[model samples]
Target: MKKYLLIFLSLGVFLNACKKSDDDLTPDKGLTPDSEEVMVQDFMWKAMNFWYYWQADVPNLSDTKFPDTVEGVEAYTAFLASESDPGVFFDDQLLFSEDRFSFYSDDYKELTQAFAGISKSNGLEYGLVKFSDSDDVFGYVRYIIPNSDASTKDIARGELFTGVDGQTLNVSNYIDLLFGDNDTYTLNMADIADNQVTPNDKEVTLTKMEGLVENPVFLSETFEIGGEKIGYLVYNGFTNEFDEELNNVFGDFKSSGVTNLILDLRYNPGGSVNSARLLASMIYGTHTDELFLRQRWNSKIQSELSDSQLTDYFADKTNDGSDINTLNLSKVYIIATNASASASELVLNGLAPYVDVVHIGETTRGKNEFSLTMVDDFEGSYVYNPERENQINPDNQWAIQPLVGRNENADGFSDYTTGLVPDIMLEEDLENLGSWGDLNEPLLARAIQEITGVTGKRGFEVKMPLLEMTNSKMFTILKDNMVLDKKLDINIQ
Candidate 1:
């Protein structure tokens, strides 16, 4: 029932039924789409055709593909019959080939819960990295969610895991081995020596909970370093459910007269775009008149919108009419990595024109587009409407989080497709992954050095910098997505 549905940091849609017959261009495992599936398929195609950002580029989504005549209705029906699975119909037929962020789910309820920061998670947040130049992969625990199975176990942050259930992890079998049906698994522990991984002969077992809700505002504290009040926050997601709590943290920082802030977004995948704006407003001044972000939709959607509807100015209040806690800082220090994406990247991109964001760590996931949560409503646009939930088709509960538009700043710079490059490039030292909030941690320490002009224990240089193959966050229900909390009512019909 929660309104936050951008819980996924990122996900990949896999539908493999090679170039087939003319009508059955992309079937799934030779299965034909039934009548019910065909109905659901109709919604998928219509939703993409009406709202997709790259709708103009995908020829299959052309308006003329199925005309408005009696014969065209029959042709549209035939077109929907080709794909067996609704997901495949969405991925293989409707989506642009370059689209990596658009995704769909069979149950909107399950997906919405995840966006609320609640999911079935073991709570061991980690990143998978290849062993320098080998097929073998290893994982390092980034952080542990409190009240989770991993929190109950002896496993903690910086712990290296080489295998699951005693089998060594490789690129091919890792996905199935970790994310497969088994709810419980033992992580084979290992340690790095001279930059090489060696099994430590220890293991930690963890189990997934049914409804684990993660509070995105992980750690917030204040410290006085070099005579300046420094506020450090480890934010994991931009979940709207925690918007008030997040604002309160900034309120605390403001009351404490914090002059400098270190925003740790190393693992945040992203969430609601509205929450992103609120978080940005919290860091920067709440200048309601100034342009905060600009939206660019498909040509059809663009044509109907006035400039006021597309442009988002920095807000002075939260969506619920609460005054936003303002920092009004001229500069901010951000810590990120390859895992940082969506709303996480939005904070960096949206604030660039105003604030001086000193980015630390590796390149980000580089996702600039924003998505909308669409469900199978009576209308073909499939836009999610809570008031019309009962009107959704009984046979199909399918929902899509499609990239409907891209957000740019006041200066019109939103080309972070490759990723936001770091000004102070630093990677987490696996052998010495420091505890959270530690000023001596490699990434934070660098930021501290920049702020305080004094350094401490900066000896650890990243021997073989780890490039994340994919992390545990990337496989979650949300997969990196920046969702627009407000809905668009463009009349496509």
Candidate 2:
């Protein structure tokens, strides 16, 4: 059955080539020497025309505009030839107002590595902030990946740093100070005196390294409170590479007879959709055949894919083909913020039909769309096979992660463009942030209180620092039109 599906997909691609009407511009075959500069551009147009969710919105992409006629072929050929850089040309063709998640990648290898939770970094995730009513800027550690230099130096989350290499961080140099392409750098610690952040004498040097695999399951533990076993999991991302480890954590929770679950996704900027489905199935053990998420693709590709294939269902197996450890919980407690997006929201929305989801913390990063990593397969380089082994395209490194479909639950409730509002609106306790698994943490404590019927002490009210922008207008413009750092693979094979 899977073999027939692959043949059907290949035939579809061949049919797409027949519509081009130009021998030199055969997209299904490789690109010609004359079209080498704009090969990626041509690929982008054809791929998006077939798969993009907003293909109907883009006039240039419409079949009527670029039909099989002689004039239509000329128009498309001219359009592709005009752009020197295909990445920029592809961006200009997208309906930016509705398509924010689609992106072009110059290096597909790095992007693929990121999907597997492997990347080049110093393993320091931090947030930049400015003091209230002042121009002073600082950054605080969010979390450090284990086995990284930052983790080795004991750089814990919520620890403030005022400068890099003894130079004070300001609005002008903060970005370079934190994210410069340097192998080694010093982070000068800060002292919080009377709510004011100042540079302290302590400093930590960090060395950046390549191929750092991030462990997404940060903390997982089971607690006994009020005679009910409560499980806590601070999951950072939905990387499929860690699916077995995630199931092991759930297996422990199930063994401990956990009745309640607290899922901390405050800083999680989502990942793989298959992992999300596994997580959802682990929570709702009985709904194996129920709809997990329905994908709505463009009209062109919709004709090729069946409704059953497009709709994902709850499965008791991981993406790596391992059996899932089910929890069978009736209710779930999720702590989320604006960073929780993509697959994170999929898990939350998909489980709402069967589970009593108690949401806490700020609103979620409303992203219901998923993207497929599209690489140039015409040259047989970077061609994705079902078996997961493929040759690299060192010459042509262009790839795209386009917003190909929107996600909906079994109830078809996916109107969260503005974001998912929290049932209990409590901001993160920045002033007194505790370790992830500790029950003393404000967000986890609140979830435990809600589960055990005990009132916990509230932390001090701390305002989230805003970006001290030197150019307010530019900042506003960028903020309103920035692509978030959340990607989901729909696995449209």
Backbone N/Cα/C clashes per model? 8, 0
Every model's TM-score: 0.90, 0.84
Top candidate (lDDT): 1
- Name the Cα RMSD for model 2: 5.5
RMSD to true structure for each model, in Å: 7.2, 5.5
- Candidate 2 backbone collisions, by pair: none
State model 1's lDDT.
0.82
Local distance difference test values of all predictions, in order: 0.82, 0.70
Candidate 1 regions with alpha-carbon error over 4 angstroms: 1-37, 69-74, 487-493
Off by over 4 Å in 2: 1-35, 66-78, 81-83, 130-136, 170-172, 379-394, 457-460, 463-493
TM-score computed on alpha carbons, candidate 2: 0.84
lDDT of 2 at 124: 84
Please give the distance, in angstroms, between residue 21's alpha carbon in candidate 2 and its true position after superposition: 13
